[model samples]
Target: MNHEITELKFSVRFSDCDEYSRLKLSRLFQFTEEAALADAERNGYGLWNMMKAGVGCAITRMKLRLNHFAPLLGENLTVTTWAKENYKDKVIYKDYIIRDGQGNIMVEGTSSWLLVDLKTGKALPPSASPYPIPIIKEEALPEKLDILPIGFFPKKVDQVQGKNTDIDINHHVNHCRYVDWVLDALTKEEMKERGVRSIQLNYIHQVPLHEKVDILRFKDSKHHAVFFGMNAEDMKGNPLKARCHFQARVGFGE
Candidate 1:
């Protein structure tokens, strides 16, 4: 396996930024995911093709750290992503986001993913003799970290009827759309006026199309809100499918 670093460039769009003129926290993850997908494709390990061969990639967890905020709409940015190592049943990937022309680091993150059998959706064991994993190591976060957490519980459950487009080759909602749901729940005022500094998410369960889902919302603070997604049963009277905690700031200047 090649361990060379792969990089991609993207521009910040009006939709990518919040009212504070910086890229939205969720969109940053989307961009980084895109970069990883593209890199995987270039490496002949694209998710779609992998599924065709009976394997699929699923993100299990992610940790993001924001340094300088890229708050300008239409600003060009570059994302560098590469695989790091293989674990027992999963592989890890790391990414760096930098402002395009100025070459400033805006954010950096690491994600863990497992390869699963498409037919059963169960994790596959790493090959006894798997390919050599990359050795590029980035700085790790400190032990005492201010990792974000989901701040609210979900309520008002609704199921999303699976549509033909709902199923990816991986047989689940496309990853980015999860962010879309969170963004969709936000009002235009929220999207335009709020700033998100950092975020960390753990993908505990997969949501299928046509599954009943519960939407829950609560304000953690004047500037922050929490959202949750769960099955209808849980929405009505159980736990949540997934909980998201968002940290927001107001009146940020680009």
Candidate 2:
């Protein structure tokens, strides 16, 4: 029995928030991702299950817009996810929406996922897929706008090494870690005062243990910023690792 749509309830744990008791941006993504995966797991396309079948799921791109800020510590939230039968890069496209207990949307986002071979790490053809994807009209977010790479902005760069804590079951840097690097670079004080209204990210390359990534940020003003960065060593002749385009708004979209 496959579900056309899956919804789950979660509580914001103590560890999910900052000193000010506000939920962190990266943690928000983590919760959303967790919900999506849990649903797929019940339908037989889960991480471990897929890996055993010689295929694995990985997110390639993500774009999120906030209608409101995340729930405070211990607040209950509802998260729903579904896949649209759209195929690109031999992968599936999924949409997500997170709401408070009142059913008012707090966050909405879309994501693209790839199915790759467990050993070779090459993407598999869509025809080879076994699970049935849902046909749902995705909830739309604002159109994407181009943001300049970090190299085109300020010169101050923050360097971070890929450590054990940074690695995930996929054996590379986890997706949430990338968001952490971005918000950390921007700082919590700034993020809280000027809440992030939206964020778009493209996963270009992976950061493995022992590798160093240079995170660069270019602030457009006190309330806006652009983040672009890449690994120190060139991968595939391109220094671009990942780029996060985000907007900072007032009062957490209230």
- Among the numbered candidates, top TM-score falls to 2
Off by over 4 Å in 2: 140-151, 219-223, 234-254
Count clashes in each candidate, considering only residues at least 3 apart in sequence or on different chains: 12, 0
Candidate 1, residues 33-60, lDDT tens digits: the string is: 8888887877767766775677767776
Model 2 RMSD, rounded to 1 decimal: 4.1
Question: Where does the lowest 10-residue lDDT sum fall in candidate 2?
Answer: 245-254
- TM-score of decoy 2: 0.83
User: Which is the leading candidate under lDDT?
Assistant: 2
lDDT of each: 0.59, 0.69
Which residue pairs collide, candidate 2? none
lDDT tens digits, residue span 1-254, model 2: 43567788888899989777878778888887888798788666777666677877778777777886556898888888887655653767788888888888888888777777778988887557566455566554533323334434554347777899989887888887777777667656667666777777777667788787666565455445666555555432554433232221122222
Q: Each model's TM-score, in the order given?
A: 0.71, 0.83
